[model samples]
Target: MEPQKINKGDRNKIYFLVIVIAALIGTNAYLFFKDRKQSERFVTVSAEKDKLRLEVEKIEVELDKVNALNLDLNDKLVEEQKLARVKIEELKASLEKAQITQVELDKANKQINELKTFVKSYNEQIIQLQKDNLFLKNSRDSLQNTLKNISNKASNLENENSSLNAKVKTAAVLKLQSAEIIAFRTKSSGKKVEVTRSSTAEKLSVRFTVIPNEIAEKGHHNIYLRVFDPAGNLLADEGNRFEADGQEMQYSHSIFINYNNDNSTYVIDWANPKPFIKGIYTVILYADGNTMGKAQVELR
Candidate 1:
């Protein structure tokens, strides 16, 4: 077959078509490569954003732990957390951009590091606070124990002083010695003599000498005398009672005497109330709530 040759205008049109096709293919290849590079950058940026989010979440978890401590800095912790959250949101928005420069990434990382530092500082504060609280508690307990010990000692001392006072009081009681009871007869001429018989007795006499006591009070004291007949009969003024040895006792007679912390003699005389019985009479003396002495007299 003989080939037909194309004219010059048609050839020029074919050359333009070929050049346009090559330019279209080159443009498509450039667009495709540009889109692929942008896609890769987006994936890297997305990964970095997710990683930063995880870091923020980790800091939030640490904040939760510190909050559970219930420390005094909890209010500040909350405020710091609020600011950190805002910063995290700002970082999230920044990282969401299609392209992040190295400087911008460095700034984001710096913000994250500041947040981490805040958490670390908060943890240190909490630990130190706990240690301080423990120390204060120990000091308070120790002080209370010391006060209790002092109180106990004071109470013991008070009791001991009271006991000593009681002993001193008991030791200061007056005593009598060399005591005697006698029966006397009074003559018409105002003379007194020992009775020859019980019927002849006109008066009963009691004599006692106070023993010297340095601690006993020096003052006028009443000496109580109790006279009992041998038949257990008390010859005394009826219903005449006084306190002696912590009990009420009847006294046949009482005599006033000045005691000067020295041996002092005293006498009490009572006219025979009735005829004296012919037997032994017992005489008991009391002074200062104590049985001072006892004496006896025989009459017939």
Candidate 2:
């Protein structure tokens, strides 16, 4: 077949159609590439937003932990807890933006780092407080123990003092030995002789020996003598009343003697102001608040 030759008008129409088809294909390719690029950008932005949200959640969790700790801490840690919570709130508010940029995310991340540092500092403080409390408790216990020991020692000293006082009191009592009583008659010539008749008796004499005791005290002592008739009548002199065992009683006679912690004999005499009518007279001697000895004298 011979090649067909087209005229100028037909060739122009064919060239226009070819150009229109190339334009349509180029427009489709451009639209497809633009749509794919837009979708990729959307995915990247969405992923960044989700990651920032996760970072905010992490910060919130840490803040919650700090808040929980604040509940258990003392008033001293309250301000720190409040500041940490404020930081968390500020970070969360920043994340509420419609579009989160990388710069903003970085800023939030810095705030989180600050919050973490605060939490670490709070933990250290709590640890130190616990240590201080333990030290104080130990000191208090030690002080209590020392006070208890001192009290015990003081009590022991008091008891020892009491015991020594008792021993000294016991050692100071005087001992008495042989006792004698005699009735004598004094004549007009002032000579004394033993008398058995009551009509002739002028005086009654009492004699006693205080035994030597090294433990007893040496001092001036008052000796009291009491003489009683057979009818239980006390032969007391004027102004001879004294105290003995919290009671006042009359003594026949009293004499002051200087004790030297040696065996010493004492003689006490009672003059008969009236006539002696005693069948038997009892004589008692007292010294240093105790009975020293007793004796009896007989008269006809």
Candidate 3:
């Protein structure tokens, strides 16, 4: 390297070039950070909007369920449902924005809370109406029986001729001689096999036989099946109720069969949508307002 004398003009030019390069680097870094923060904000807003939309969807589903119940909804509930629909549409429109602010998110949350309140009140009213209707029906049925008894006393001698035949019904109740239950699981190819583990079991098959009795009535019979989990909770697709032993009770499944005084086997399948627990399950079958049989199954 040869040592050369540097002029003032050349030194000034070198200083200017260094300053330009530093400025470009600083500007690029600032721009990169700003873009990253903006992207993160957009992602957060999108996630929040998705969560809010799910809440609205839940309310919409509940509304559909109430309407499908076919209950006689009062004026207030109907109006509330109408308001909920309108608000749901409004929220959908608000969430359609590409960028949602904190204020908008808060507002959507508030609206969803109000919609939840409407759904709760709507459900409570439906329950109350169902209970009232059931009570009225039971009372009317009881009164009619009472009136019939009072009016038929004058014909007691005539009724005595059929009393023997009527007494036969008491002995006509169907009784189960043997019952069996099995659990199964389905594979990805849709093949099913018996399973011993609760988590793998998806369905249960129940087979029962009625005891042969010469005096038993021959006609249609309704059999209600109850399956209780290890926690004593009934597993049912829907909370269907029926009268058994003079009381209304929930059933897990139901079957209908015809009896001809001959011992015959019947089969019914129960598919529980939820996962089963590993413990003993109690299954009780009922027919003719009496417990026909009870069986227990334990899973690993």
Candidate 4:
């Protein structure tokens, strides 16, 4: 075996060829593993980017919806404000109408109060007039009886002169009962009297009778009435006449009575339109220039 020994140069060449082959195989395996790892990393990064883009798009859509809702809410607020203003105007108008109605109601109440006062005054005047009418009818019956007795005695004395002279003396001494006032009231015709509220005028009816004695004369006798106001001032007559207490007064009313039967009633209606003060009034009656009777009346 020693005889065929190999040369050193050939052995070196063989070992160098083996090293080259090993280096080539190691380079090919490293290149394949590095490429595969790079490809997988790229795929993972692409998927992550897609996921982030989708999430951003979803957030933008939600923001748009929120903006639309905000706009709708703003429009609703504007409409509500307008409606509030209109309601306030209507309330103001209603309040003004109510105030006007209240004023009208107050005025009507005042007018009603005034009318009530006027009606009360009218009723009082009617009651007083009725009481005076009953008093004048009784006084006229007594005066007629006195005149009949005197006429019978005078007829018997017509034939004898001395008896006539004696009869005249008897007549002078005999005192006959004076005329009595019967009733006094206001009247329109024969009916009971009524006064109109606006006219302030009243019609007075006075009735009386004269009672004759044994020597009573049968003729017309004069009767007069003097009216006094609340202040004791004499009432003026509508007719122009200037006289007082006997000389002929500026205002005087008179009546005449004729004796007939045992009794007779005389009625005189006097219409007066004078304004009377509210107080007590006096009426004085005179027959044959002498005071016969008096009456007092209140005029409120």
**RMSD to truth, every model:** 5.8, 7.4, 37.6, 38.5
Clashing pairs in 3: none
Which number leads on TM-score? 1
Residue-wise C-alpha lDDT for candidate 4, range 1-300, written one tens digit per residue: 459767899999989999998998998888888888877755654454344334333433433443454332345444543553353344334333523343443443343344334334422332343343334334444445556666666765665767776667445331224322222334656555444331343544455554455465567766666677678887756674433335765444676767554766666655444664566656666554345566555555
TM match of model 4 to true structure:
0.32
- The CA lDDT of each predicted structure is 0.82, 0.79, 0.85, 0.51
What ranking of all candidate models by lDDT puts the best one first? 3, 1, 2, 4
TM per candidate comes to 0.61, 0.57, 0.48, 0.32
lDDT of 3 by residue, 5-74 (tens): 8999999999999999999999999999999999898888888899999999998998898888787777
What ranking emerges by TM-score with the best candidate at the front? 1, 2, 3, 4
Residue 215 in model 4: lDDT: 62
Better of 2 and 4 by TM-score: 2
Q: Give me the displacement of residue 181 in model 1, in angstroms.
A: 2.7
Better of 1 and 4 by TM-score: 1
**Model 2 lDDT on a 0 to 1 scale:** 0.79
Q: Cα miss at 299, model 4 (Å)? A: 2.6
At residue 27, candidate 1 shows an lDDT of 100
lDDT per residue as tens, model 1, 74-146:
5765687688778767877886787777688778888989989987987787798889888988999999999
- Cα lDDT over the full model 4: 0.51
